[model samples]
Target: MCQLLGMNCNTPTDILFSFEGFHRRGGLTDHHADGWGIAFFEGRGCRLFLDDKPSADSPVAALVRAYPIQSENVIAHIRKATVGPVGLANTHPFIREMWGQYWIFAHNGDLKDYHPAPGQYFRPVGSTDSEAAFCAIMENLRQRWDAPPPLHELWEEVQSLTESIRAHGIFNFMLSNGEFLFAHCSTHLHYIVRKAPFTTAHLLDEDVTVDFANVTKPDDRVAVIATQPLTDNEHWTRIEPQQLILFKDGQPLYCS
Candidate 1:
């Protein structure tokens, strides 16, 4: 299994604060350390970064730390090499095109002996079950619609697709199409929402602290989801096992 970090906000926000603690988990705090990637969505486009090296030690990560790329939606992953060989292609937060928009995906669990039927519209570029599952979902969606459907309808379909794959094994994952963010927790996941009257939060992995109230606007709202809570002082609610939540404008629009 790997680790996942996602952010959805009402306005564009930089992930540097959360990423600081998360990157350390690749080799310093937790030792997943195989490959890592991150994607930030700006309108219809995405800025993606990937590396086969440990995120903590990867030279690519230095640029990530320096660049304050802001986005309304973001996804990141650090691999632990469960099924795929270490390489850039195997790094996660995989991206694909669908319905004239880009989609980003990342998984944090293992599917035992899972294999998917070949898809005409989408296929895994890498040999990991995570990517296979992603392609499967994309293929299924493409089969169901020629164009983008309503958010509510698409959300239900995505939820159903995820439920079908849950039988294979642990299936915690995050998906986004820039407009909405979906998170499914098969085992463990936690999320925190920061907004008006924000408070100071301290990273559990690093010796850094941020006073969010001082840095953010009064109306800014951001939802941060991770395999584990990144901050020690904030009250992060654990997403119940097997529950799927859809977030929009930094709010949980639906949960099931």
Candidate 2:
């Protein structure tokens, strides 16, 4: 299994503090260490970085740790390689284009003996079931509608596809198109939101601490979702299995 990290904010925000701890799970503090990748959505464009090397020590990962790339939506993954060969080609956090927007996806669980129907619209560039699953969803979305559907409509369709895939095994995943961030939990998943009257938080994997009040505006709000809680002091909410959440502007959009 892999680990996933996602951030959705009302305004552009850097994920440096959170990523610093999360990336260590790729090799140092934990043992996910196969390959890693991250994508940050800035306006209509996205900045992405990937490496086959262990994220804890990859030179590219070092550079990412040095820079504070700001974005409104971001998704990242650290892989453990259950189905595919450990190489750059099989990395998670795969990207594709849809509805004239870039879509990023990252999975955190493995499916058992999964093989989706052959698709005429989208295909996977890698051999992992994770990639195949992503393609399946994208293909379905493309075939179901010519343009991006309404958020609630899209959510229902995605929720169905997500459940179908989860039938084979775990289907925890995060997806974003620079507009909405969708997270579906089939196994373990947790999230926390920070807003005005922010407090200090200490990373569970590191001794580092950050006081949000010192750096963020009063109106700033951020929602972070992960396979596990990244900070020990935060009140992280565990997302129930089979639940799908649609997030925007740093909060979950509840659909009635």
Q: If scored against the real structure, what TM-score would every candidate get?
A: 0.98, 0.97
Identify the candidate with maximal lDDT: 1
Model 2 per-residue lDDT tens digits across residues 1-256:
6899999999999999999899999899888779899999999999889999989989988988899998999999999999889987789788999889999999988899899877888888889999999999999999999998888888889988887898988889999999889998988989999999999999999999999999899999999999999999889999999898988999999521
Model 1 regions more than 4 Å off: none
lDDT of 1: 0.92
TM-score: which candidate is best? 1
Compared with the true structure, all predictions reach lDDT values of 0.92, 0.91
lDDT of 1 by residue, 90-197 (tens): 889899999998999999889987899989999999899999999999999999999999889988999899989999999999999998899999998999999989
Query: Positional deviation of 161 in candidate 2, in angstroms?
Result: 0.7
Cα miss at 57, model 2 (Å)?
0.8
Clashes per candidate, residues 3 or more apart or on different chains: 0, 0
Over 4 Å off, model 2: none
